[model samples]
Target: MPEWWTYRLEDFLLFSPRVYWRMFELHNAAVWPLQIPALALGAIILVWIVRPRQWPDLGSDRLVSIILAAAWVWVAWSFLWNRYATINWAATYVAPAFVLQALLLLWIGSLRGRLHFAADRTVRGVVGLALFLYSLVLHPLVAPLVAPLAGRPIQAAEVFGIAPDPTAIATLGLLSIGAGGAIAWLLLAIPLAWCVVSWATLHAMGASESWIPLTAAGLAVLSRLWPRIGSGALR
Candidate 1:
């Protein structure tokens, strides 16, 4: 048997590069124009995090949490297991992780009232806000930019709730904005893993966006740690 260490990255790629791109093309068509409302809601979520008092009702943020959780489940079933898994076997395992994350979000935010977002102007909070903006507006543009650079036609832009890329990015921001704890870490595991997996996939595809997922993971960590450090709290 071949030694695992002798395996190259390409060996693990089960699909042709063209097939991978085609998947996104078909996905874009399947979810055409849902991107608009998804992007709009993402932006509103960012604004709400920045000025949470605007809602002024206790547990009102629960609505946003519910929305985010629903998105997680949506991607798990709709994109990962239903679509992407057909081409990449690994995504089948990843799909259940996304489902677990969704349940975590719902359990913590909706049932337990443990997950909440607010603006504190602390180092962490500011970083969280920045991540939120990145996921909402800037994340979609990433695909288009990488397309020409990779000598491909413009790629279908993905948005939060409607697709995995933005959903992963937005989840990073949410984890950062909420109180970081064991439960937060639990919620964070799958997204962080997805980012790493995505990094490898993009790298294999010769897309410049290859590295951005890892970068988002790093930023999410920093956003989580910065405030805790400043307050001399690390748990």
Candidate 2:
């Protein structure tokens, strides 16, 4: 076998660039208008985290967690397994991880009531909130700006449930909002790993926002350690 250093970017790629971009295009087409609801869900979660008087029940946290879980399931099946795996076979493995994450979120945030939304007003919370917004609004704006660089259209932009960028970013935000513990560790494993994986994938693809995942991952680590100033209003 060839040595790792000697390998070209293409060697790591299972699909041609055309196939990859087409996958994104088809994914966007398949999930039209769904992104609107995804954006709304994210916004609601962020607002809930930021202000508690509007939603006195901790159940809002649980509800948002379930929404996030559903998004994970949708992408796990619709995008990764259905579209992405056909090109990048490794995505088949990744899909199952997403499913497990969905289940984890459902159990902790819904069934167990273990996922309390605190820690969001800390430095970590600020970073996490920024990432969530980046995934929703900022990243999509780049869709038009990077069109020339990527040779694609706005229609091809990767939305939250339809692609990894927003999903990973949104997850980082939601995960940070919770009280970190064993469940936090379990919840973070897949997303943090995906950030690294996606950083490499986006770098290899020469896509815009290539560095976003890695940056978010780093912030998340720091956010966990120094969250001494969390918002007091979380229930």
Candidate 3:
């Protein structure tokens, strides 16, 4: 037997790249039509962040939390537990974390009313909006556009709320908006961890897009920490 150190990441992979992507395709097919309302919910979240006046009460921090909590729960059950676990057994473990994150969002943002968001033209805000939009609109197009080049089906595309990557990315973007207090850090923890996990998994699969989640995670950390470092909060 080869030494442990000689083993590459791909050596530990239980599924092929085709199997990985096909899981998404099958998942999308099984959950047909739900994607439409999921995208609509994402648009509503965007509108609340961009034009708060339109929603007023619904735009409040609590409502955003409830919406995000619902998204997490949906992704946990529909995608991670139901679909992903069929391909990767580890997804069964990951689903609980997603559910825990949903609970945290509810307890902190909804019940305690600790989270907040507002529109701004600052560098952080711009980055946040860009990341959010990328996750919502651009991320779905990524697999569809690239998969065909790789001889994979375009139907493997991952949508915002239905998939874990986009959901985690969008959550980090929204949290970077104006979320404060230590609760913000608590909220950021799971998504950031999932981003790293995603990057590792994709990298193991030899996917060129492995950097997507890692980049999002890096930018999120920098966006949240830069302001503090600039203000001497770190010192």
Candidate 4:
């Protein structure tokens, strides 16, 4: 394993108990599972109602501008909340990272949209797979940092101007779904989104990291081959 991997694994294991407790809250038994269906239905209803009145301007700068504006909104909200709550630096960091993920997706999706590459099967599939992997890994990696700060008092920090609270960090972690499956869903979603876009963009630019997509594809194929060969010996 890479030196970084060994280090991170050690850190993660050290915090396993806290992580498990946080995981419980993330997957708590409540009205949480219904939230998935509710939110999905609401989103579908929203899109149906707001169906594009004009053909989407795939080449418009508006895509970029809107993305920037949305990002600023999150930042501004965090700034004010942090100011009043005296948020800890660590808590503030968590929100910005989550916002960055959304921004990245919009940026990539918009690029593909502008180039009219969104319809291409190969492009979409590659992006989808990369995102799946990224989302999964990113969560567990960052969890340790924020998890340790959860028990801190909700008092403002002079540096960050916001108080650090478990609620905020946990939510930002996508582990606040109040249940376990929700934690799993978020863990799956965020990294995958990041990877798909990053891989697609790098591949398009013909960067050396293009090997990443190939590696992912190879592993996927190998995974499929594994079960079949193992079954044959048993049969």
Candidate 5:
């Protein structure tokens, strides 16, 4: 047998790229028209994000949190627990984390009423908007566009509120816009971690879009940190 160090990342993968992409195809087919309402919900979230609002309002913030929490719960139950676990046993473990995130969002935003999101013209806001649009719109198109080129199924595109990666990405984008304080940092943890996990999985599968998650994570972190860095530089 070859040495452990000699083994490629792909060597450890239990499922091939075809199997991985096909899972999405099956998932999409099974879920059917739910994608329509999911996309509509995403559009509503985008409107909420861009709408003019004073910071820390109770009603809007709580509603947004509830919406996000629902998305997390849906992705956890529908995709990770139900579908992904069949192909990757590790998904069973990951589904709990998604549930935990949903709980956190609920406890912090709905119960305690802490999360506040608003549209700002700052660098972070732009990054947040870009990330949100990418996750909601562009990310779904990725699989369909690449399918023709890569010979993958066209119906395997992942959508926001449905797929874990896009759900996490959209969460990060929403958080970046105006969320602050320790609670914001606490909320950021799981989504950022999931992005890394996603990047690793796709990288192992030799998927060309593996870097997308890592890039999103890095930009989210940097956008969050930039204000601090700017303050320190000025001081």
Candidate 6:
């Protein structure tokens, strides 16, 4: 891990635009034209692995399920951490979380069991382990590359809407209104909602800095224990 105390904001800022710009472009509006095919490919791979013996005849709309699954993962990840104010090691960890959630939700939404445990375990384990190692060893060097894109920092209480000031309220209100009410609502709601819940759950247990990992591990254990139960149970 990089020495957080030694790293300056400018160092991070210098690194983010190049890496995150590509990620943004791939995920942004201009890529909508390619989404269908990409989604279709994902669906095909999912189907091939999960329930290869019992393929569904969804025909042209097979991609719809995959697309929906991907969207759900994005929303879930954003919901998990966006409300938190700090952009430290934990924030750096969200990328892996997003990918993990995306893949699992993709499998869950398939319904047809289009992706089986063997393939799922291989992919998840490999990717998860790689991410863990990267986050551990390369974090200091790589972190600066994406630091530039970190949004304006805000107070923890302000982020959670505990003690909002007039300026903060107006700024967030404008952002919400400008992005369309629904987008704004997510920006405001998920953090205030899930973060608060996670925090409360952690606090009640008298845990602190390790809360997120503990919560994540607990969820992972639950997920594995009831693999047949589906996303609704764990999600």
Estimate every model's Cα lDDT from 0 to 1: 0.77, 0.77, 0.85, 0.32, 0.86, 0.32
TM-scores of the candidates are: 0.89, 0.87, 0.91, 0.29, 0.91, 0.24
User: What is residue 61's positional error in candidate 3, in angstroms?
Assistant: 2.2
With candidate 5 superimposed using the best TM-score fit, by how many Å does residue 151's alpha carbon deviate from the native?
2.0
- Supply candidate 6's per-residue lDDT for 96: 52
lDDT at position 27, candidate 1 = 80
Choose the strongest candidate by lDDT. Answer: 5
Pairs of residues at least 3 apart in sequence or in different chains that clash in candidate 1: none
After superposition, candidate 6 runs with Cα above 4 Å error = 1-72, 80-82, 85-88, 107-201, 204-235
Residue-by-residue lDDT tens digits, candidate 3, 1-235: 6598998888768899888888888989999888889899888888878876425444466787888899999999999998888878999999999999999999988887777766577656777888898999999988877865776665778898899999999999988885776877899999999999999999999899999999999998887877766741322
Q: After superposition, how far is residue 55 of candidate 3 from its true place, in Å?
A: 7.2
RMSD of each: 3.0, 3.5, 3.2, 15.3, 3.3, 17.9
The better-scoring model by TM-score among 4 and 6 is 4
For residue 142, model 2's alpha carbon misses the true position, in angstroms, by 2.3
Query: Which regions of candidate 2 fall more than 4 Å away from where they truly are?
Result: 1-9, 53-58, 118-120, 227-235
* Span of 10 residues, lowest total lDDT, candidate 4: 154-163
Model 3, CA-based lDDT: 0.85
Total clashes for model 3: 0
| Residue 52 miss distance in model 2 (angstroms) | 3.7
Q: Candidate 3: how large is its RMSD?
A: 3.2
| Window of ten residues with lowest summed lDDT in model 2 | 226-235
